[model samples]
Target: MRVAYYCQHVLGMGHFFRSLEIAKALADHEVDLISGGPEVRAELPPHVSLFRLPGLMMNDDFSELYPLEPGRSLEEVKNERARLLSERFLLFSPDLFLVELFPFGRNQFSFELLPLLQDIRDGHFGPVKVVCSLRDILVEKSNQEKYEARVVKRLNEFFNLLAVHADPALLRLDETFGSLDRVRIPVRYTGFVTTKPRSGAGIALRRELGLEPSQKLIVASIGGGKVGGRLLFAALQAFARLGLSGARMHVFSGPYMEASEFLALEKLASAIPGVILEHFTDRFLDYLDAADLSLSQAGYNTAMNILATGVPALVWPFDQNHEQRLRAEKLKQLGVLGILEDADLESERLAVRMAQAMEAGRRSGPAPVDLDGAANTARLLQDLAS
Candidate 1:
């Protein structure tokens, strides 16, 4: 079987990363990936092929924004992508064509998916099942509740299934969208998408960074290029003030962080006895494994990674939108994460939160959240193809 997977995400690597996991699950099938976002270095399984759309990103300048990237709009780039895909779609026509959460997300850009879905439904396209895959939450941003209901209706009519890759035991994000039709599809809560670690691996990424056994590790990450220096600086201050003696810290300031700014942070770390700061390294999770605590802006992929790693982290969420803060609240309520608002987060308070969480973490284990979904998700996709 061959499957076509589509995703267009901006700012964070969550969408792409999740899609990658699904693609990995279907390694036996011929899968084609259609993505639109800033370029990222991801290890694609050998069976999957990539089709890059016009590089797209969210336009923070305007409200209700998903601006076309410069040098080429994803629309124009999408044309070439579509042209290339149309041929392959007809030739390798698969059992399913799965869209990752935004036959509704593009909002403005989804004008293309409807026609494609119509073709599939009307039998104009090859024999295929179209599925809409969504993550646990959908922070319904721009569209009015009524409009989303309409979109759900449209999706229900066109797609074969609405796969909610999250546990129903978790909170329902559909309430926020209020689309009975969309919610009513052959909806399957496939559990959360978390990458399982290679078990029994005790590789200490902290020791790799030259930290001693006595020092505590703090693995901090800001996704590749889009981190706020001011926000991160505040977290660093917190780490510093927390003042755990002989603690060794490792900071990953993503690719986009300014070199000059990072150099300053590195210098600051050097002054400290055991703190270390470096540009974002490819060894992200390894460092995560080595750390006693983690600190990052709350993003879906980052949050999932932390949870999957089962480490206690202080999530200092961005004030960009309420969704991040909302999740932060949920994690805080669960006592799985510590929260610090952007405006109010200080190094001193952060230090207190971290010191407390880590000291407590030593005694207790990760919360009783079941992440057995990835394997189940693999089985489901495999069954779909079969």
Candidate 2:
């Protein structure tokens, strides 16, 4: 089977990474991943190929769309994207169309997506199984009733299935979207999609870092780094205050952090000993596995990584929406991680929390939530195709 996966990440890289994991899991099928957000560095599997659309992203506030290429008007980019998407649909003629966070989210791209969905509905791409790949929680909209109605209408009209990438035991689509019963389609929970780190990778990494058994290794990161400067800066300050002997901290500022913010973080980190800062790394999971403690935002991908590695984590949920906070609260109840509050950002308080989290050590035993979402998603798509 050939799968054409459409993913548009306007603000963060979480959606892209999660979609990539699912594509990787579909090794038995050929995958054409359509992406239009800011370019990200990743290693694609042999069976998966990326189809880049003219870059389009949201403003910091996510109020409007802008072209990534300078001097190109938003209208020009949208027109080109629409044309390319239709052309690709005809060329690939994929058996499955896996759309990430559409109807549920990424409604900004409706000018392109709605047309493509319409074309597929008209049998322009032959018989294709249309699936909506959604995350666990949704950001509350300005008019939720209208939003739910629109989603139900779109899903029923164009989509064949709704594959929510969450463990229903932890979160269900209806919990966030109230009109689930109104949608006339199959909605399957494919667990939480994440790539598990290689076996013993963390242990090997710890040894390679030449760390003593007594020394603590803390890993800190901000997903995409566009809005995580506060958390990273605060974490660095807290680390400095900890003053723990033989402790090492690795901070990934994320690839998208503004240069000014990253430079500021670099300057601050340079003053502290045993602190290493980098823009990004492909071996994020390995580092998480090797870490004694993890500090970061509570996005779906990061939360899944913490769960996959069983690392003791302290997450500062994104304040703009209830998505991260709600997920973090669930993990907290499961004793899988701790949440960070605004007052906790104070260096002194954060330092204390850091110490306590490290002292508590890595989470032990099995993960409370299902972590086989990537493979399960592949299986579901394949079964549907069959």
Candidate 3:
């Protein structure tokens, strides 16, 4: 089967990574992964091919859309992207058309997506089954009834399946988006999508970093570094205040952090003994596996990694949306980690929480929740195709 996967990551790289994992799982089939974010280095599996569109990104607040290339009009880029996307559909004629965060979110790209959907609905691309690939939690909007009606109309008209990447026992779609009963489509939970930790990867990494037996290691990251300036800054102050004996810290400020904010962290890290500053890494899960404690924002990918590695962590949900906060609160109830409220994001509060989390001890292994989403998704697609 041939799968055409469309993913547009406006503010962070989480969506791209999640989409890539699912594509990788379908290694036995032909896959064309279409991305509309600024180019970033990534690794895709053998059966997967990339189709990059003109890059468009959102501002920090997600209010404005702009091209990654300056001097290009947003209208022109949208038109070109729509044309390219339609061409891919005609050429590939995929068995499955999978879209990430559509109708429900990424509504900003409706200019292109709506046209593509119309083309598909008109039978221009014959008999392609459409699916919506959604994360566990959704951001609730005001006047949700009207918004949900639009989504239900679209999904019922164009989409065949809603593959929600989560465990319903832990969190169901209705918990966040209340109008699921009104939607007339088959919805299934594929469980949380994340990479499994390789055996001994953490031990090997610890040896490579020359971490001593007696030293305590803390791994900190800001997913994509788009809005973690406050968390990273507060972390530095908290690290200074703790000054735990034989404690070492490694911070990945994320690749998209502003240059000035990262430089400030670089200088600060230089002054602090046993502290290291770096950018993003593909081995993020390994770092989590090696850590005695983890600190970061609550994102779908990061949260899944922490769960897979059973790494005790301190997570601050990004406040612009309720998704992360709801996720954090649920996981906190499970006693898997600690939460630092946005209202209490001071150095002192962070330091206190970090210390408490570290004392809670590392999780022995992956959480009991479902973690076979990638493989399960591949099977589901194949079954649907058959």
Indicate the worst ten consecutive residues by lDDT in candidate 2: 358-367
Candidate 3 TM-score versus the reference: 0.97
**Where does the lowest 10-residue lDDT sum fall in candidate 3?**
359-368
Could you tell me how far off, in angstroms, the CA of residue 339 lies in candidate 2 after the best superposition?
Answer: 0.7
Which candidate number has the best TM-score?
Answer: 2
Better of 1 and 2 by TM-score: 2
RMSD for each model, in Å, please?
3.0, 0.8, 1.4
Q: Residue by residue across 45-124, what tens digits does model 2's lDDT show?
A: 99999999999989887899999899999999999999999999899989999999898888889999999899889988
| Residue-by-residue lDDT tens digits, candidate 1, 1-386 | 77888887676667887888888887667888888777767888899988776665665532343335556654566566556556656665767888887655666555557667777888876577778878766564555766786667767787767777766665565655566444556776777776764543325554555667667888777776465566567667777777777777677777656678888777776776666676656566666666788878877667766777777687777666666776677667766787766545666766777788788773146544556555656566666656
On the 0 to 100 scale, the lDDT of residue 191 in model 3 is 93
lDDT of each residue in 320-345, candidate 3, tens digit only? 98999999898888888788877557
For the record, the alpha-carbon RMSD of candidate 3 to the native fold, in angstroms, is 1.4
Please report the TM-score between candidate 1 and the true structure.
Answer: 0.87
Clashing pairs in 2: none
Instruction: List the candidates' TM-scores in order.
Output: 0.87, 0.99, 0.97
Score each candidate by Cα lDDT: 0.69, 0.92, 0.88
